[model samples]
Target chain A: MSHAVHSPARPSVSTQTPALEVHGLGKTFHIGGLFSSQAVRALHRVDLTIGRGEIVALVGESGSGKSTLARCVARLEKPSEGAILLDGIDVLKRDRFQASRTFRSQLQMVFQDPFGSLNAAHRIEHFLRRSLTIHGKGGTGQGSEAQTRRRLEELMTTVGLQADMLDSYPHELSGGQRQRVAIARALAVEPQVILADEPTSMLDVSVRIGVLNLMRKLRDEQGISMLYITHDLASARYLADRTAVMFAGEIVEEGESLDLLANPAHPYTQLLVSAVPDPARAGSYDPVHRARLRQAVMASTACAFEDDPHQRCSSEEPVRHQVGDPRNGHWVRCHLYRPGAGAGGHALATEPLPEPQPAA
Target chain B: MTVSQTSFGSHEPVLDVKNLTVKYIGDTRSTTAVDNVSFSIGAGEVFGLAGESGCGKSTIANSIMRLLKDPANVAAGSISFGGKDVLAMSQDELRRFRWQDVAMVFQSAMNSLNPVLTIGEQVADIFTTHAGYSRKESLRRAAQLLELVRIDPARLKSYPHQLSGGMRQRAVIAMAVALKPSLLILDEPTTALDVVVQQEIMAQIKDLQRELGFSVLFITHDMSLMVELSHRMAVMYGGRIVETAKAHDIYTTPRHPYTQALMGAFPPLTGPRVPLTGLPEGVKFHNIPDLAEVAPGHFVAPFDADAEAGVLEGAAQ
Candidate 1:
């Protein structure tokens, strides 16, 4: 079950200063109306931090609390527990005025449904104009009307949209263009962090790479932090520096993007990574591989994986244990990774996964 | 796999679509959705139509099924199923042909399945209506169909809402295959499901195709799935078939710039980092040159673009 994490010595950049920190976040939804007592745990005590100008991808299957976590951070839904601290300030603990004004100004959310989210009756200019006017933050660029116009043009240019597109309605633009407009709107506020939830899932496959490049540019050039949430792992590996795998309502594994994808420790993560239909890795996704994945447990009350040894998965809780060698700070939340209690700490983390055989 | 065997020397294909052009007839302007597309699905062959949205991949599939309504019609095309002219079929003949001859599994499983009806009832309904079987016999067949998709036969009595997303998709597949259709048209069939479930569904589709020997017209924007599943694939762009070749050839050694871009658009999960940057927005592939045989079995469209444009400008090279 051990898959060796492979990557050359990464350029060690100082990740001392944190941009955003989330501690023990959780959200639960009540099933019925106010009358019923049944509740579903959508998110559990999730903890992670985004470094300055870093892109951390939150990957999972549907109903895996990925969207729920992004929503909680975006403040679309109130977190039932935990704190969302931006620059050491607990945004959730702030007052209503602070939450809307001070909290919202620093963080922006780029939605998946770009066309549906924007008003069909308004032009593209209206969307950006309203955002810059409302949350531009004094002296940050949009000081006067003329400055606002220039800033809007700059935002449009940054996102690879034309100046004439500002006059066009949302419906007039193609699906890809509307998405670029949505991304431009997120950048207009000069936010320090962007919570993009499946922004390119609805766009064309040809244009999806363009948007991902734009996102990478945003992180590298603008020095903006991001929590890119999606079900697609391939895209994440392309755009993100680090990745956190979520299952049900918990973060099962997290590490450097290439390391995590090349060597997924958690069973669910392994299944997802292997499930990607790579022509090069065709042997790994054959019928026998599919059968192994389909028979995996769904919505288990115990630990998420079926490969939990020591039986502590069903009896007790699983905590995140740091992986050794090649994966400096990589963590996996499985009983197998537990030290001394199991087969020892990262004892089997040596063998490199079977390389793809040349296509027959 | 058997489809390639038939394509090697056979003259009569399972599904033959020639010069299929679909257009939206507006009052002022008419825009082509699918134009001059030609392809054939050999017996037991999983032929794929690979393209991005609005490239008219779905339009071609719908034209084959005769499911296009007003505003969207087959402007010029010839569809033949095993030597029978589908375009010349009468309204009654079309009704009898659909589902019995070719079954369509739509993009959304929830929208495809009848929410009000139970799984067993829906599967039985298809059998009774098409095959004219008795209720008891139809249901007995329904249970067997449901089991084919690996769904619990006991859950056949459960509603569509009762099943999970993956289960609902399996139920829809079970229902589509109830009459043992010769061809299956799947448009992004497993796009909504997660990767793990998608693998399961794909495995089932392949298993069923091998057992039943049905030709599949698999339409999706996912190039990786095309590479892994299809025996032969046609790359579509700007409503035209840009390239056609063996699936492996198309993935590994694409000739057309559009085909290369489409393949490069999908990032490999585990490989050397190869960033994909597509063609410029101003590049028009509408007036591409005639399809030329680049290799023995591979066909590619010639281009008249300069060095600064098309596949030359991006990471596809």
Candidate 2:
């Protein structure tokens, strides 16, 4: 692909360890009282890796467990199972009860709601200074105050905000400006990895691109890895180097962002790609077809492609199958891609499905 | 007015707004939220009003519904629905006109719904209040409305929290169309919904519109969704319409600098990846001149020579 040539900021393949690596990450929530508690599986064996300077986008609907995965990685929620490796070191095993200061400094998280994340009482500078002091970056000496001031200004500049805004409260700034301040606070600790969960979803459409660009700039210049969790496929395609599509608490498809979206292997991913509003494409909204597809997707417990006769997709869990070139890192968790499923299944997996027809 | 006449030449206009201005007055200062905005929705057409927050899209919707509270007053304008002046309606007449002639679906369906009551009770309340139907008849009609929006009639007894976000929105839509209103104003109806659910809701709205034949004032910040659903659209910026045209024409060739910047904000899913700077830093197209008909049905606010040169330079990158 010409992405290498066009995107000079793309990190080359290096022998250095990945910034974040998640293996068999799973989370299950217990609901109701102790008499008869119900176990709800929020995540299931999610395996992901983000290289230094790479942005991997996790895309899914509200209940698809994308946020849960991010929470697990950020240590907000303790994963039920699996290991989390930060810079090839297993931090989960080391710090069982609480996240160590090193782990906190190395991995920071930016939440969705900028309005709710920041304290209303504190000024923008207070948040950044707190992060710096908590991480031991801000010193107590006389010259240290100037050093901290310079660092705060640098952080503000990195996130494309003016130093004068440091005095403003959360309520005084606009949604976009508040989000930039949030990013600056995350950057205050000089994190190696940042888990951004729907960072720009709450911001205005015109301002969303600015935040996405800032994220890319951070990855390119600082070599910081990022896990961008969002439901918007178009934004993920624009910002992420790779995309992993989650469906019903599982990764349905994973590959290079453009390649996966352009040639979606999983039925769920196909549905998502088709559902995204594309102005260029002719309007295709068949209510009946959409209803049937929604029903099928919701009804399936193990796999989305439950109609596949060769494989029992409704009951049996689908395994990951490589699609196209192995080096492309394109794969799908679908029964259709299973080995020896049949010629028909193989053809279905290879050729993309036709777009839904517009209403008559 | 000429632009409306050209666009709605075949179909009759359901809602006509002319020189509409809404201002929020403070003790010492007054700020215009909707500044001399004008547009008309043809019968059975989806007319989209798109802009960022605080651009006065919602203010226009509120003015049309006469739901503006204290401090927010209609400064100047005439809003006519089927040749009847909306601003001149009496309180009693306005109450009847609201649900019987026009209905609105707010941004958040969850907030719109009464959490303490069942879906059936909420839907039935509209019919009982406006249509003067008996409780039994209204309940039956509520079940039918639920079915129309693809929600199970059994869920009629369920609370708003029991249903998903998409279903909650559908329930709201079902309620809005219960009285068979001539106009339905949806203010960011599916903004809180997921992509798939949003598509489904849009499709459902399209199907309902086709069946019932009601004009829609679909307001949202998402231009892609707006283009997909709207027949004609007006792009708002700084309390003024910057561009107005057919959905296809606006998508293909946007003339206004704000419209162009908005179009560039959306990155394509299946195209060459390029970094797009959405809006230039600190660039505001404020206090623009009136819209001039650039094409047959296309209307664009003509920027002055100095501002035009600057905006073009800023947006062109």
Candidate 3:
């Protein structure tokens, strides 16, 4: 990795109320025929929190439920069961108009694709002014039009864009520039919490860090709490304070960014970390070797259940138990962590079975 | 540059570009899309072109394929490929050479597949256009091409939407290589997929190239992935080649300041902890430095000759 996104050392998490809190979140979609319904559980009692000014990352593969979680928090999709508290306000309980207006100011999102998210016909200034006008922060009195234009210029500058760019339509800008415009539009409202889902994936490599650095700056200067959702672990390690490794709608592990990356506790997390294409490794992609690796990874699956363990753990059905140093805030849910658990072992509370040998 | 392939006694590159510039004539004034850029790709080697958005990476790719149309116009320079200049080729010749000699896989081109058509039909379309093969023969060759990409022949009948994203990408790549084209141009081939899928696609591309002895002009923003795949990589900035070197030197010790800043900007999955730093303010490629050859094979563009020479001495070891 030639260029990387980094920040100055941040202070450790304090004992203050979280900026955003989610508890026992669950979302289900009905599939198949109406009468013969099949419940596809998108989220399964997931729990997480974002400390003030901390960038918490939710890392998961596609179809692993990261987007679902983001949508739930954004209240774009209502959760079937769970509570999301943003600045002590129950986001779900608020009336439609009140929530829409408040959400515009307090919570905002930058989407995955800049091309799809931004309108092709509108100039950059149109997007900048809409958020301000719609959210009732369109500036007051004394040639407010000039004031709005000035603010638009400032927003563009913060995102490393020139003032002349305001006249350009979305299609006229590059992927990175368009993304910067999207971010500037989000910031026009001065949102307290930002949810960025794969913001840099669609952009060219050279300009990706420019966007990431902007988010870090927002976190440091404005104290905006961000929920960065992505499939890339390197980005998660770089931009997050706390990393939550999600698989099959459950957080297999959560801890300090460096700690989790340096020493991953879960099998899935370890595979992900190892799978990174390290340039240092010569002949890394030998055809037979990669095929073997793929086969091995696919062979591994979630351990099946024998009996229920507890209300939340058993009622909801856990692949394993959460065991680790709760004091250090490092949590791991896998057979490796359970007491008396070994390779391929079940959770500690469950009936014992013969342990399998460590995987080669 | 090492110029390992240059020993064949050809003073000219297999592909030579000189003072190449492109502009897009929009509704307003013509925008200089690609400045006076110059670079070349040799035979049987992967030449990576790395840059960010608006850095004119894609413009270079499109120009090489003769795919740029409408608003885009090549203002200057020449592109010589396979002993014939590409810019000078007639529409009919360009079309003939497109798949038979120089094929291109666009950024997310796999996603552009016709959803209604089966994977077999897509591969057959290429064969039909280039070789005028019969349907039965094309189907047989399609199954073989699918096998080459590690996908089962049974999937040839599946629609584009039915196959997984990875499979769809493989099908597109398979089509590009159906005729064993001399050069394959991949523009951000795996940007949309997950890491695992990205690796899978890259590995397939690499294996196929090695087996077929076809050259690749790989373009991406991911330096790590580029390093892993390419034999040599060129860093482009403001429509110019800032640095070019063997993949090893480019990764371990980059010569250019822009390359250095870029290395510092990306996040690594497994490596020593380097505190992530933000892009510096008011930094411009032309304003800050000049590019110079620091090592035997690596060249870095710095603002001035003195600074370039100074950095070169430090990098000599």
Best by TM-score: 2
Per-model TM values vs. the true structure: 0.86, 0.90, 0.79
10 residues in a row with least lDDT, candidate 3 chain A: A340-349
lDDT tens digits, residue span A273-295, model 3: 65577787756555454333333
TM-score of 2: 0.90
Question: Ranking under lDDT, best-scoring first?
Answer: 2, 1, 3
Model 1 lDDT at residue A37: 85
In candidate 3, what are the lDDT values of residues B140-179, reduced to their tens digit? 9999998888777888889987776767887889888887
User: Residue A177's C-alpha lDDT in candidate 1?
Assistant: 87
Q: How well is candidate 2 docked (DockQ)?
A: 0.55
Q: For candidate 1, write residues B188-261 as lDDT tens digits.
A: 99877777677778878988988887889999999888878899998888888889999999988987767766
lDDT of 1 by residue, A250-358 (tens): 7878988888998777766777787777887664655554334323322223344445453234323556655555444577785333211111101011112232121
What DockQ do the predictions score, one after another? 0.49, 0.55, 0.30
- What is the per-residue lDDT of model 2 for residues B1-317, given as tens digits with 9 covering 90 to 100? 22222334356688999999999999999999999999998877899999988899999999999999989999998999888899999999898889778999998865778889999999999888878999999999999999898887889899988777778888899899898888999999988877877877888899898888778999999999999999999999889999999999999999887787788888888779998888755547767889999999999999775766577566534
Q: How do these models rank on DockQ, best leading?
A: 2, 1, 3
How many Å off is the CA of A39 in candidate 2? 1.7
